[model samples]
Target: MTVVIETRDLGKTYRETVALADVTLSLEKDTIYGLLGRNGAGKSTLMSIITAQNFASTGEVRVFGEDPYENAAVLGRMCFVRESQKYPDDFKPGQAFAAARMFFPNWDQDLADDLVKAFLLPMNRRIKKLSRGQLSAVGVIIGLAARAEITFFDEPYLGLDAVARQIFYDRLLEDYAEHPRTIVLSSHLIDEVANLLEHVIVLDQGRVLIDASADDLRGRAVTVVGDASAVSGFTSGREVLHTESLGRVTSATVLGTIDAAERDRLTAAGLDIAPVSLQQLVVRLTQKEEVR
Candidate 1:
């Protein structure tokens, strides 16, 4: 696959604090990528810089083999959907969608109209009169209907209900299958969106921690549970991520996958093996580890 987005030693600083640090990543064309991290972890900052909404203090960014900053040709191919997308206070939802149709070359009015009805968004109401969930729906609708070559959604489902969110996800996947464009989704709902992601990029503080395919990440860690003594014995020379003890029972998460030999040993010791949730695995990786 061709590379659509690339960054080298990307860094951003605000006053004396670092927003993003020494990050290098490449995004392949026509793939769904999940950019995940806790709030204030530089996910938004990176998205802003990549979309040319903000400047990078250091390093380089290239979209479609060209610099995005001040480059309308490259910028025209990208659509950024953010939680706080602003519109004129007097503008109605219908007006917003109409404006988006004009700006995005491949805009699909039928799709936009369908999403408006599906989300139950009030078209005639002023933008400021809509509830948070309704406002979020407007962003989601535009993001999907614009059909830009590269779309970046930065927590676009912030206040949407479960049903609305599911609709957004379903529409995104369906349109992606038909259009086949590069889509980068920055979200905090890790487990909910895990299945939609082909690749996962996790950030801790301001640095990139994990960047790998979902398949590789699924097998990157495993948990073992059994009697305290047996579990402790099994985990002794391994890289442990998390551990929990209750009475005489214990469960632990380790950094490596369980191979045939390891599995046989655990089975012989009457221990149980389970796959770790991507959310739990990431939480452990980015959080302060507890002492046993």
Candidate 2:
């Protein structure tokens, strides 16, 4: 796959507060990447720097092998849908769509029209008067319809109900399949978008915590549940991410792969092995004091 975005030792700081620290990664063409972490984890900051919306304090960012800062050619190929996108006070949803149509070269008006109906967004209503969900629908519609070579969705599901959120996800996947493009989705609802991600990049405390394929990450940890004493004994030498106990029963989530032989050993010890979901794994990994 061709590399669409690359960052080398990227660092961003606001006064004494560090937003991103020595972050280095590459995003490939036609791939769906999940930019995941807790609030204030620098997910948005990194995206902002890559999209040239903000300046980096140190290091470099390359979008399509060129600096994105003030570069119209590179910037035009990328679309960023911010969580709280502001529009003109008098502009309506239709006007917003019109502006987006002129900006994004690949913008699809037909798809935008379909999304407006699906999201039940009022075209003529002033954007400021629209409900929070409706406002988010406007951004989702633009993000999906823009079809830029590389698109970034920064918390695009905010204020959207479960049903509406599902619609966004469905439409995004459908359009992506028909027209493959590089997409970076920053979302707090990890499990909700886990299936859509081909690659996963996790940030914690302004640093890269995890960067790996979704498949590899899925098997990076396992939960052992059984009698407290047995579970403790089995997980004694392993890296325990999290642990829970209910009277004599305990569940310990540990890092590392469990082979067939190890599984047999665990079962013989009367311990139940459970697979950890992506959400659980990320939460546990980020909660750790030292993940490096």
Clashes of each: 0, 0
lDDT at 152, model 1:
94
Residue-wise C-alpha lDDT for candidate 1, range 197-279, written one tens digit per residue? 99999988889988999999999889999999999998899888989999998999998888899799899999999999899
- Tens-digit lDDT track for model 2 on 28-86? 99999999999999999999999999999999999999999999999999999998989
For candidate 2, the TM-score is 0.97
Q: Where in model 2 is the C-alpha error above 4 Å? A: 290-292
- Enumerate residue pairs that collide in model 1: none
Go through the candidates in order and give each one's C-alpha lDDT.
Answer: 0.92, 0.94
Which regions of candidate 1 are displaced past 4 Å?
288-292
The prediction achieving the highest lDDT against the true structure is 2
Report the Cα lDDT for residue 133, model 1: 99
